[model samples]
Target: MRARLMEATVELLVERGFAGTTTTLVSERAGVSRGAQLHHFPTKNALVVAAVEHLTERRGEELSRAVDALPAGGNRTRAVVAMLGDHFASPVFAAALELWVAARTDEALLAAVAPLEQRVGREAHRMTAAALGADESRPGVRELVQATLDLVRGLGLASTISDDSTRRRRILGEWADVLDREMARA
Candidate 1:
């Protein structure tokens, strides 16, 4: 039931934005009573935050599986960039975008969302680092890994507003090339 409610919340958030995702809508969409939803999540903030956390964790698992499936000692840079592009274009990121926009104006929501966002960001960083076979002990490797994430995230944000698939592909390819060259120099 909890999972159902969270899933419904994510769907509604992606479809309707934060303003449209009320407790009533979520309960109805989840096919559960308001009472049941309230029993599990006492407030709208709690419910939305839980939904974001749930989706983030699920996406992280999916990313991990995708990473694990990549062939070893090949062009990991291109593979990682492609995988991240798919992830950024996903509904999970759309839902997260809604939350981020809402949180900017809503203090209560920001308070609830900040820690979860931090955790998600950290997990993404760690995953990117691992995918790149980054040696964290190196001075600039970690920074470069973080920059890759930032670049991918920026590309994802642009994609949310426009059909930038061609541009995104080009950027990813170019960035992968740059990263390859930089890593060689390092």
Candidate 2:
């Protein structure tokens, strides 16, 4: 039931912005009783926050599982970039984006999401570094990893308006080459 509610919440968050998503809609979508929904999540804030957290965790786990398939050598950088790019362009990213936008104006949401986003950002950085086999101890390498994440996130945001897949792939490919060179130099 909890999983169903969370899944419903994410779906609604993507289809309807945070302003449109509500406990009533989520309960109806989840096909769960209102009483049960309240028992699980006492407020709208609690439900959405929990749903986002659940989806984020699922995304992280998916990345970890996919990391094994990342190429082992020369093409590894491109593969990692491509994989992360796909991840940022996923529905989970859209749901998180809704939360981020909503949090900007809603103080209560900001309070709930700020720390969650911090943790999510840290995990993304750590995962990207690991996936790239990047040595953050080396100078400039940390910044490069951060840049990669920022670039992909920007690309994802752009994708929200239009299909940027062709341009995105080109940019990521070029970035992978540069990233390889920089990592080698570092």
Candidate 3:
């Protein structure tokens, strides 16, 4: 029941930003009673925050599985970029983007979301480093990994409003090439 409510919350958030995702809507979407939602979540902030955390954790797990499934000793950089591109283009990213925009002005939302964002960011960095087979012990590798994430995130944001796949694919290829060259130098 709790999981259903959270799933509904994420769906509503992704489909209709924060302003439109009310407790009533979530309950209706989840097929749960309002009282049940309140019993589980207590507040809209609590529900929204829980939904974000739940989705992030699920996505992280899915990412791990995808990365694990990649062929060993091949072009990991391209594979990682492709995986991240798909992730950024996903409904999960859209939901997170909605939370991010709302969090900018709402202190309560920010307070709830900031830590979750940091946790997700850390996991993303760790995943990218692992996927790229990066030597984090190296001085420049960490920054390069972060830059790659930043670039993919920007591309993902662009994809939310428009079909930027062509440009994103080109940038991913170029970035992967540049990253490979730089890592070779390092």
Candidate 4:
């Protein structure tokens, strides 16, 4: 039921936007009673926070699975950029962009997004470090992991709003080139 409510909240976010989303609307969309929504969420921001958390976790899971296909080595550098490039080209990316924009003015939403963002950074570092088989504490490897995460966000933004696939590919290629260099160094 919480999942259903969160899913409805996301849909509401995409459709009615933050200003328009309400527990009443979310409950209606989720086919739950208003009392049920109150029982589950207690507040609009709480529901929105859960929705954003759900979206972030969903994306993180998908990213982990997609990047898992790459071999644990320098070769995965390009594959990381390409696979994530493909991921950002999806509708989910656009939805995420919407949530990010909403989070900018909403402190509660920002708070909700903060831990998830940090977790993503940590996970990306772990994955890249694993690919390079680096000592987890290595400084250079940490930098590369951070850069890779930034690249993913930039690529996701470009893919979400840009009309040019060529541009997205070019950026992905550039990120791949950078990763290729760093992965070798590590």
Candidate 2 segments exceeding 4 Å error: none
Per-residue lDDT of model 1, residues 1-186, tens digit only:
989999999999999999999999999999999888899999988999999899889988989889988997667788888789878877888899899899999999999888888989899999888887777786777789888888878888888878888988888888888887777777
Regions more than 4 Å wrong, model 3:
none
Over the stretch 110-155, how does candidate 4's per-residue lDDT look in tens digits?
8876776577557656765565454546557677666766766676
Q: For each candidate in the order shown, give its overall lDDT on alpha carbons.
A: 0.88, 0.93, 0.88, 0.71
**Per-candidate clash tally:** 0, 0, 0, 0
Residue-level error in angstroms, candidate 2, position 21: 0.7
Model 1 accuracy (lDDT, Cα): 0.88
Candidate 2 accuracy as TM-score? 0.98
> Each prediction's TM-score against the native?
0.96, 0.98, 0.96, 0.78
Kindly list the per-residue Cα lDDT of model 3 for residues 50-159, writing each as its tens digit.
99889878988999899988987658778788788878888888889989899999999999899889989999999888888888888898999999888888988999
Ranking of all predicted structures according to lDDT, beginning with the best and ending with the worst: 2, 3, 1, 4
| Per-residue lDDT of candidate 2, residues 9-30 (tens digit) | 9999999989999899999999
Q: State how far residue 132 of model 3 sits from its true place (Å).
A: 0.7
**Clashing residue pairs in candidate 4 (N, C-alpha, C atoms within 3 angstroms):** none
In model 1, where is the ten-residue run with the lowest total lDDT?
Answer: 132-141
Q: Provide the lowest-lDDT 10-residue window in model 4.
A: 130-139
